[model samples]
Target: MLEAIYSHLARRAAMYLWMLVVFVAFGRYFTLTINVSDSLPGTVFLVQKGAKPGKGDLAAFRYNGGGPYERGSLFLKRVAGMSGATVTSHDVGYGYRDYFVDGEFVGRAKPLSKAGKPLKPGPVGLIPEGHYYMAAPNPDSLDSRYALVGWVRDSQIVGRGIRIF
Candidate 1:
């Protein structure tokens, strides 16, 4: 009876180990991110890097522009405009702005940062190939609305973000 019990335990352990190995091997294509900013709903997310991100997809990317924010820091935002899309913005008064993609109004933008400094407006005109415009759910979010993060290149994309919690 004791031998049978040990044999059962050993088989269970081996199965668990095999499962772990499979997870590790296939999981390399995915990443986990914790949203610390209010740009989107704060939650843990699963990101997949298997394909190119598209407009309306949530994406995780590295910030490559100069600013107080560190380079290579991960930023999560929604893809608002893609290659060949004409992007534009205008002052909407009351310290707020509005953005457009392909002449369709997208969202309102904050004119100033939380520090009270003026935020640079997003780039205007067609987005080049391999470039994307990112936007946040919150109007006050510091995303592609500012020059600091005007457009993201395909090379900077880490993956497509999927909210897990």
Candidate 2:
């Protein structure tokens, strides 16, 4: 009886070991990489080597709040302008749909403040090196297009949007 029990236990141990090996191999082949948690509720973006974002690349980044990031507050925006791209805002007087980038006009950006005013003095200036400017599809979204968030460095970017589905 003792010999039988030992054999059974050994078989179970070997089975577990085999399962572990299979899991490791599967993980190596199908790597599941996720960067943001509840703090950043956005899609998982894949990092592309030597890839430069143009006007419409979705950028995922961590929101650097004064303290720890609060759930549902942080966001990931799409790349509107790349490094060295100039930005400007125009005051339309009535509603204020004014914004420009890289000496070329883009669009208007509504302020997050109560004033509902766009960034003052028109031209917001050029996007710095190793940094990418971003904006959200949601008009109410607080993004780098505003002065508060500003330009984000490349390192801050967790990844780029690959597939939405």
Candidate 3:
């Protein structure tokens, strides 16, 4: 009788182990996905193929490369510009706000909007290659808006991520 009881317990333990393995494998393969940050807290969309966000395209980065938030800090920002894209600003010019993209006037017109929203000024030069310009929607978020993390590289991208539960 003791041997019989031991055999039954062993069988039940094996079954439980098998169930655990199946649960873990199923979750990993079927239910696992990536998620993005909730900074804008407004419209959210997926990155479809051919929907490339060029200069001025708001994007999110995988890791911070010694930026304002230190290393490993994630970023969500707009594509202020891109490689070879022109940029201009008045922050260091000691004058009114002025900027242009492809020689066209961008949003840089007024220094401060009526609602106290500062104008989206431009940088004081052309964007370099192998890197993309970026900025944050909210000032509170750590992004290229800060003086630290400037342009991020394409190689730094983990993947065109999406919010998946």
Residue pairs clashing in model 1 are none
Candidate lDDT scores, in order, read 0.84, 0.58, 0.52
Give the candidates in order of lDDT, highest first: 1, 2, 3
Best of the candidates, TM-score = 1
- Per-residue lDDT of model 1, residues 77-145, tens digit only: 989899999988788788677889888776777777777777767788899999999988786777777
As a whole number from 0 to 100, the lDDT of residue 153 in candidate 3 is: 76
Cα lDDT tens digits, model 3, 1-165, are 999998897979988889999988755533322235444444443432223456655455655544223566545556667788766654435334544545655433334434555544334477777676665444344444333454567765433323322
Worst 10 residues of 3 by lDDT: 29-38
RMSD of each: 3.5, 6.5, 7.9
Q: What tens-digit string does per-residue lDDT give for candidate 2 at 1-165?
A: 999998998879988889999988755533233534332335454544334455687555655553234533334567878887887766677545566666555545653344444442223677778887777555445566555566777766655554332
Listed in order, each prediction's TM-score against the native is: 0.83, 0.57, 0.49
Q: How far is candidate 1 from the true structure (C-alpha RMSD, Å)?
A: 3.5
Predicted model with the maximum lDDT = 1
Model 3 RMSD in angstroms: 7.9
